[model samples]
Target: MTPLNRKKERLDGLAASTAAPAAGQAGGVDVMDPVDPVGEAGAVRDAEGVSLLASAWRRLRRNPMFIIGAVLVALFILVAVFAPLLAPHAPDDRPLIGQISASTNPIPKAQDGFPLGGDEKGRDLLSRLIYGSRQTLIVGVLATLGGLAGGVTLGTLAGAFGGWVDSVVMRVVDVLLSLPSILLAITIASLASQPSQWTVIVAIAIVQVPVFARLLRGSMLAQRSSDHVLAARSLGVKRSAIVFRHMLPNSLGPVFVQSTLALSVSIIEAAALSFLGLGNPDDSKAEWGQMLGAAQNLFDLYPHIAFWPAACIVVVSLGFTLMGESMREALDPKSRR
Candidate 1:
């Protein structure tokens, strides 16, 4: 071979030899593929990077508390949704006076196809409870939404725009926070020109607004200084886009979890307003609290009437609480499960 050919061959061999060990090193580690921290970090992040909602749902399904809550809530929802179908009797229908003897008293127990028997007004207790679930759920859910809508608007503006706006908003929030929620609700509801369902919902919603507003504001403030938000700012994204599209969406996990909890509170508040004669006073409507209030006088003679509604309120409230607590746990980054 010519000297040039030999030199070319030698160079090729040298290059192959240098590349071989790097490709298949003794320790099984790749010398050619040195660790790139940024790339590795990306991988690690992706590995942990399921969407928040999806991750929360996964955890929720597995959590016993969530399962229990979901089941109770679902059952209640079904009962509420299918109230008309499920109620065997008209909620306001009274039993035949002669059919049920006077000796049995106004409230009967576990007879005449009425499993839970009759209320003071002789309406089927089970039927009333079933129908009442509908009104309770409507009030609870609608009131919570009202609060959430108002609160989100106030909180987003206050947190996203800081300084004087935030100061004014937070001060108002503080004032609201200082008062007892129930007491404030009572005051507001009582002040209404006519005590009705709307007043009760408005009162409960007004009480909840400060709670959600403070929560969202704090969450937003914390996220506003975060790396992603700063990056969005650097990219010349509009403040509105960064706040609504980025910061708001990211900070909503806590709000959603709290909203579930707030539903239970709203239910209780609405019920209390009704009990206090500030809500629907129509005895025919079959509201749990109203039923209880009507039965209060007869408690000594027929405690069973109060028992059913009270139990319902407790169980439904507990269900929402468990759901909220489970959500809080699932959303927390530090939680192993």
Candidate 2:
């Protein structure tokens, strides 16, 4: 045979041999079995179910800062939950009323019944401190939830439907962001004809709404242009699914971190409002901020009254801040190493 015919024959024989089924196979090839052209399909399938939050949690498990923060937050929550059980006396009870005379020190020193001593009003200082954690937690969590609801709604609407919708929402956000957080909170608190615990919560929530909305909006915008979003679009996935499933879920990492940080800020701001005489109207209620506010005049004479609450605030805030920062690091791909 000529060289060309010989080459063609060799090629044809090679193709026939390749097409032949193996000894164990029933057919030429398993047509039903899906092809994994790149050899990465198994790996992709294994990883596909893992979400960002799950991955972040995995990272957080090994993170020392996260552990410390989580422990502190847990203790704080536990103290708040068991305030009634933990506290030796009722928050409003004044058992040592007779001890507070012009001759005797208004604030009592550590004694048998009161471990942390007594406040000016003769209420158990330790009891109030424990109960104050509950009040503080309530304000922080509720305010954050309220703000989160409003912020998420505005952010989702702005991001999912850009153009004029984005413009109007952004304008409102801008107006809110323009004012300083404390100033804004003060203004909102002032607007309330009756200043109560709810007033403080609402004020803080309003201030935080803009912060969360802006953060979520920015994250959403970035997600909207991501490869997965583009792929979903090309695959003719519904826009709602893309926004809700792909974009919003992916964008919440930063928001969650911000929420953690915001809790600390809310507590501090609540204290500030109370200090400014805009907190709960009830003088007998046990709140950390209110306690701090009440101690202002007595701060110089008896530092422990102010010191205890302030220290609690600082420690608790530090815990939340640490947790938030760790979460941010965990969520950031660049910080993974």
Candidate 3:
């Protein structure tokens, strides 16, 4: 036989040998399982490399600023949750009407039962501070949540369904954004018969809606042209799934960070509205800004009344700001060391 024929026969024999079954086995070669590239990449990225949350936690733990911020935030929340237990008196508690109305300073002396001091109205300062946290927390948390939800919804829709949807949503966002945040909030608040707490919340949330919406929109747009999104489209994956699952999830980190930071702003905004005589002036509720507003006239003589509430607002806002900065640093790959 020619050399070429011999080579061909040898190849055929090798293939047949490989294909033939062993004594107890079916016909097949021993094929090793293929590695899942996607899963492997996730393992590498998630377990060891750049997990957003895990690495953020690691970095946060290592950060002294984050520690301080976390502690302060924890304490603030504790005060809010346990105002009754922690406070020495009821938020609306006052000294005897005779003695209180009978004083020149009108500031309850920080002695006997009262510890921190008293406001112009004779309500316990410490108690008010403690209870005010609950209101502040309510406004901060709820307004931020509302804004986050609204922004995410609008931004996702705009980003996913470009063209007219994008234009309409963006135009609305632009209109809201065009006005200053405080101005927008004040304008909306003015529509209310009085600055009820809910009105303040609604106004702040409305002001924040544009900010968060723009932020999430930018994030969504950035991710829309990413390789993974295009790949998912090419694979004929459901568009809704790709948008919600693939794109939106990846775009949430910045929005989350912004939400935290905006919460701080939200609290300040709430306080500002109350300070401006725009919120419910219920002394029992002990809102920070209202306390400040009430004390403005008495500020010359009794600064502590103003000082305590201002301090509460500052401390909470500072804590959130610090934590938000740390989160931003941790989540942004470019900022990671």
Candidate 4:
């Protein structure tokens, strides 16, 4: 072969060898392959995008304490809602009046149709207990709602304005906080012309106002210094919008938890008021605390009368406490796993 032709043939062979390996390597793996969203890496991306409240809820659903608390709270609500259907007899009816003997058995023994027997007034105990759930639920929810409304207003004003406004609101809260809860409730209740269910609710609500106001104010203050709030301010967000939309919303987490805890406290406080004769004066309206108050005179002989109502109060309170505590833990960033 000629020298030029030999050199040309060698260059062609070298180029072919390089091109074959490059093509093989390009065909070996596809760069456009779709990712599996259900895989580990995808899961991590999803987790990173989850919201704080949503993450807290996810954790809450897994907690055994949360489950137990949820169940108890649900049960209480069900009982309250279905009280009319559940009570075999009218709560105020005293059909078992003949069964009672003041000197002997002031309260009737358990029997068919009347499983829990009769109270001091000879009213069907089982029916009264079932009906009491409704009253207790009402007091708890209304009191908490009232207190929350008042507290949120004060907290919002204080947190949003700061300086003089904060000092004024906090000083008022401090005064309320200084007073003993029960005594404060009593004083409020006494101001009313007559004792009624509403009196108990209002009294409890007033007593709780300070607690919620302080909590929300503190939370709002913390959020005011947070990155998101600062960013919103830098972006020229309106002052009112920043306070209500940003600060108020973020500050509500602790307040919500407090509301749950406050439900239990309200119930207990209602019972205390009732026991002190500040509850509904009408005997027809059955309440657990009222029952306890009426039965206190005969507690030595008919302990069961007081036992049933007191037990209901304790169980319901425990349910709220469990739910509130679990929620607090779930929402706390420090407690997150």
Candidate maximizing TM-score = 4
Global local distance difference test of model 3: 0.85
Q: Candidate 2 or 3, higher lDDT?
A: 2
Give the Cα lDDT of each candidate: 0.89, 0.90, 0.85, 0.92
Task: Return the TM-score for candidate 4, rounded to 2 decimals.
Answer: 0.85
Clashing pairs in 2: none
lDDT tens readout by residue for model 2, 1-337: 8999999999999987655534315664543324545334544543457777788899999999989998999999999999999998889999877788756678888989788899888889999999999999999999999999899999999988899999999999999999999999999999999899999999999999988998999999999899999999999999999999999998887888899999999999998898788999686779988898899898888999999999999999989998999999988989986
Q: Give the Å error, residue 292, model 2.
A: 0.9
User: Which candidate wins on lDDT?
Assistant: 4
Query: Which model is ahead, 1 or 2, in terms of TM-score?
Result: 1
Error of 4 at 242 (Å): 1.1
C-alpha RMSD by candidate, in order: 8.6, 8.0, 10.2, 8.0
Q: Each candidate: how many clashes?
A: 0, 0, 1, 0
lDDT of 4 by residue, 1-337 (tens): 9999999999999998767656766999433324634333554333357898899999999999989989999999999999999999888999999988888877888998988888888899999999999999999999999999999999988888999999999999999999999999999999999999999999999999999999999999999899998999999999999997899988998999999999999999999999999989987989999999999988987789999999999999999999999999999999999
Give Cα distance to truth, residue 92, candidate 4, Å. 0.6
Could you estimate the TM-score for every candidate? 0.84, 0.83, 0.83, 0.85
Better of 1 and 4 by TM-score: 4
Off by over 4 Å in 4: 1-48
lDDT, residue 105, candidate 2: 77
Off by over 4 Å in 3: 1-50, 101-103
